[model samples]
Target: MVAVRIAKETGLAIDRVTFKSSLTLDKATLKAVPAGQCVTRVTLEATVYGDVTEEQVTELGEKVHVCCPVAAIFRHLPGCEFEPVWTLAKAE
Candidate 1:
């Protein structure tokens, strides 16, 4: 799992980014799913200080999710669920 935060001014300048990823299993079930072989989810928190619209951010995120390598990998998995959480804060 990874979390990213984007604090941008009216000009949309990213300020900070935080991310993390890990793997877990049910002890004996470790054989079914090897360590470091799964990606739970990725979350992106962005705060924009501009006139950016929600549609724009959502569209961009959709595009990224489709091409994101990690997401694509999990897409083909049997029980892997891929989700991208986006939090956009628009400045006045």
Candidate 2:
């Protein structure tokens, strides 16, 4: 699960944000492991948008990646894994 924060520090009313996913994992390795095997992978993709510049979006995304609770949980726990891949569209 991914959560995005888009509150304006400049006192602007940027109340709208968008999240999108363009890619997902084809298969998860957890299924092959024994039922007791703790190893697992959780995959996801998301995009966020609001009344903000590209730079702001990038910063927010970076912060979200750094501060996500699920990410932190997986990092501290043993045998859990995550593989993230990103695709960028060409600018027109």
Candidate 3:
């Protein structure tokens, strides 16, 4: 399972937070038998009504990334492997 947390530290009355995620299963053979692997990807999005600086958003995102439980768990596991990617876009 993948988890995402979003927080709006500064914003006007239109501040909003959203999360998106998807899961997929893949089959692979390690030695001879078949093994199933579950892959989950999560994305977090936020919109602030007022003007928000890029530096502030980057700082907040870094804080959230550091404190995220899922990221901690993935880091603690020694043999687990995963692919992680992150992106940020301004609202239109």
Candidate 4:
């Protein structure tokens, strides 16, 4: 995924990566709450494995918002709430 690409580019030597995400939206309307908001809340969690530092993981988390086109779109939604969680682990 995006993290893998970034790690390869930055020489992070990643062995594996896992991700979990959740999207919350109004069920009844199934549409924008205030006529511009598409998603209400988005939670994305990434567990990265490599010989990387916590700072590097944090950087990856921040950079995803800038590099991922879909994430960028979600970030701009009028009333959307974005939450990104990053976890780092040693490569096995």
Q: Which candidate ranks first by lDDT, i.e. highest? A: 4
Lowest summed lDDT window (length 10), candidate 4: 29-38
**Per-residue alpha-carbon lDDT of model 2 for 1-92, expressed as tens digits?**
33334345433223344443222222464467554344455444443333555555556555556777855654554564654322222232
Candidate number achieving the greatest TM-score relative to the actual structure:
4
- Per-residue CA lDDT of candidate 1, range 1-92, in tens? 11122222223343333333443334655567665344343333433223446665565456556766665765665544555554456443
Clashes per candidate, residues 3 or more apart or on different chains: 0, 0, 0, 0
Each model's RMSD to truth, in Å? 6.0, 5.6, 5.9, 2.8
How well does candidate 2 match the true structure in TM-score terms?
A: 0.44
Q: Estimate each model's TM-score.
A: 0.50, 0.44, 0.43, 0.79
Off by over 4 Å in 4: 31-38, 90-92
**Per-residue lDDT for 24 in model 3?**
38
Candidate 2 worst ten-residue window by lDDT: 83-92
Candidate 3 C-alpha error for residue 4, in Å: 12
Residue-level lDDT tens digits of model 3 in 1-92: 11223443333122433444443333343444433223322234433332445565555556655777866654444444433343334667
Per-residue lDDT of candidate 4, residues 1-92 (tens digit): 77778878878777877888898886766653554454688998888887778898898878776888878777888778988888896545
Quality of model 4 by C-alpha lDDT: 0.78
